[model samples]
Target: MPDLLGRKFTANEPNRVYVGDMYLPACDRGGKNMYLATVIDAYSRKLAGYALADHMRVSLVIDALAHAHGVRGSLDGAIFHSDRGSVYTSQAFRNYCSSLGVRQPMGAVGTSADNALAESFNAL
Candidate 1:
């Protein structure tokens, strides 16, 4: 299992932000258009990674996590936080988090403040 993520910012630009974007192609699944979402890191502002797929399933999130983990090893039980979405709640993501030994944390339902970090980064 991987460790947690560190809160320390080593780069000079500690306030910098990184952005990632997901674009789902046209596909028919459950009679709904697929969706995409990105997760970015603040500080060392860079497009760390992204994920795009036919559906906004939990697997996509796990794929993103794999990409991130591949680039940066071991989160050291760091806080893996996200909005309270169904995909985030899916077993795949949960299992992936468990395997990585990362703590899964979520914001309150319908509360923007909980995901302020992600939203703030997106706004930037």
Candidate 2:
């Protein structure tokens, strides 16, 4: 997969680009785990949108993207970067991105540095 971000996390304009990732709690109590999907602006380092759910399904990611789209008001030609997670690679998510004119960019598999910003955000 090509890196649409070009390993550049900074952008001149907002809403034109973003990076996203999913974060799960360190421990799961009672066999229950909560997932947080977040989209952040590359230029401002501001959180565009986020969603929390008990599952890490595709819908969780979709909802996060939807929320980002909603908050941004428009995402046409926006570049969304993420890791090679199944939810981000699912056909449904691809279709959703296509329908919204958002470009999905994936970094190298198993390379956390490719998506450092999102990982950094998750660390916080």
Candidate 3:
């Protein structure tokens, strides 16, 4: 759908809302670089889930979401907000979210402000 997170930085409950993003580590080891995918709860500002891997593939994001699902027990009707990255826009990730009864909301292209919370989290 649209930018569900929009500019509002609050959620009514914990597991019902989350923001996700992928970032590159600062220290590159010269070899294959690693990426970090993080999902944070909007209500409590708690890290719902995260995954680090050698690739920024769609599976990385799926794994992070799965981790969040595992920790939260359920993500039914949860809104997963993220930027318009290919990994987030892939059909596989979309199907995965649908299977878990999660709603995938994407931010505008090239607009970091659309996903400010997740971006801010990545900064830290």
Q: How many clashes show up per model?
A: 10, 0, 0
Ranked by TM-score, the better of candidates 2 and 3 is 3
lDDT tens readout by residue for model 3, 36-120: 9999999998899999998989999999999999998889988999999999999999999999999999889999999998999
Residue 97 local lDDT, model 3? 96
lDDT, candidate 2, at 69: 89
| TM-score against native, each model | 0.65, 0.93, 0.95
Q: After superposing candidate 2 on the true structure, give the runs of residues whose Cα lies further than 4 Å from its correct spot.
A: 26-31
TM-score of 2: 0.93
Better of 1 and 2 by lDDT: 2
Q: Name every residue pair that clashes in candidate 1.
A: 3-75, 3-76, 3-77, 4-75, 4-76, 4-77, 4-78, 5-75, 5-78, 16-43
Worst 10 residues of 2 by lDDT: 25-34
Name the 10 consecutive residues with the lowest summed lDDT in model 3: 25-34
Go through the candidates in order and give each one's C-alpha lDDT: 0.58, 0.91, 0.91
